[model samples]
Target: MFEKDQDKEEWTLSATLESPASVIASGFGLDTAVGEELIVVKAIRGEIYAYETDLSTGAWLLSAEVSVVDSSYVSSRPWNQARDIPSLFQRVFLIRLED
Candidate 1:
């Protein structure tokens, strides 16, 4: 949806995560609502990827590049006894689903 006087667009969640770390999502919704879309995707480690939506097949049919930003170094040592501290992340992308 778009406002008549504003040049902005909107996204509404057409799907939801099926398991742990459930996050409400929409392609267009309020900023706070859309911001929650990443909770489920950020639960895992390793490479993550995205694809362009393929309208012909009704899918996100193209595999985009995957990027890994590991913070294992931060969790490498024990919290109390470790010599070095580990890095952390605010988000992680794990699953991809089409609605």
Candidate 2:
């Protein structure tokens, strides 16, 4: 689900990836059979909210946020050191702005 309020310059986006393994495999070249779920929301001011969950049980795994101009990400849960933040954003979100 994605909504945009043009007059207010506000927008929200939500997506569910059922086949996260395939996507990750293609995007990062990592081979794994684990199931992962992700949800992301962005506000007009440049704050991005991301959530990761268990695909099977819908339990929350990790929650994080990042500012458009900042690379420092804050996570509500302990983050996995093996995952690279920038690469995940590029491959999963692929956010872009156009005039």
Candidate 3:
């Protein structure tokens, strides 16, 4: 995350994720956080992360993580067989990229 220092035009890197993953989807939701805003992020490979913003600090904090209890990373959300199959093939092809 980047933030601007007081009286400065440049943005500085303030925080970094311990384990960064590509964000596949995200949505805002109301949770039992005592009025805190929640942002739900579904990452690539079906891992989920929740972020809460600190109104005082202007920074996002990782409040929770939903990991797979099993070995599979596939999520339970409904998927489109037609588009999903092609996308899966594309991902496989990209993973096989070589110099």
Candidate 4:
């Protein structure tokens, strides 16, 4: 999750995920930090990615376990003007393989 440093507000990135896979976040040109781990989300074409921060090179390289959820509740709200309303909303669980 990325937030504005000045006001501490949550920020959301708009992305599209056609396949279920790990992505690198770098194109957004923002740094992602969860505790001591820092990363970058890169946008390639219409997709967003998450990349591991390279301490030696000062760059964000590809890493693992970053999932992009399309049509998620976090991404959807009030309603989406582009798509029809969902009939069945199911629960979602995000699990890390090698925590």
Whole-model lDDT values for every prediction: 0.27, 0.33, 0.26, 0.29
Give candidate 1's TM-score.
0.23
Ranking by TM-score: 2, 4, 3, 1
Residue-by-residue lDDT tens digits, candidate 3, 1-99 = 324446733323222222223222211221111123432322224233223434554435434444322212222222201223212221111000011
Worst window of 10 by summed lDDT in candidate 1:
79-88
- Each model's total of backbone clashes: 12, 0, 0, 13
TM-score of each: 0.23, 0.29, 0.23, 0.24
Give the winner by lDDT: 1 or 4.
Answer: 4
> Model 3, stretches more than 4 Å misplaced?
1-35, 59-99
Instruction: TM-score winner between 3 and 4, please give it.
Output: 4
Q: Of models 2 and 3, which has the larger lDDT?
A: 2
Give the per-residue lDDT digits (tens) of candidate 1, residues 1-99.
Answer: 212223422112234435423443422111111122222222123322222223344333223333333335322322111122121121222234344
The list of candidate 2 runs beyond 4 A from truth reads 6-8, 13-18, 22-37, 41-43, 52-70, 74-99
Query: Which residue window of length 10 is worst by lDDT in model 3?
Result: 90-99
Q: What RMSD does each model have against the real structure?
A: 16.3, 9.8, 15.3, 14.1
For model 1, how many clashes?
12
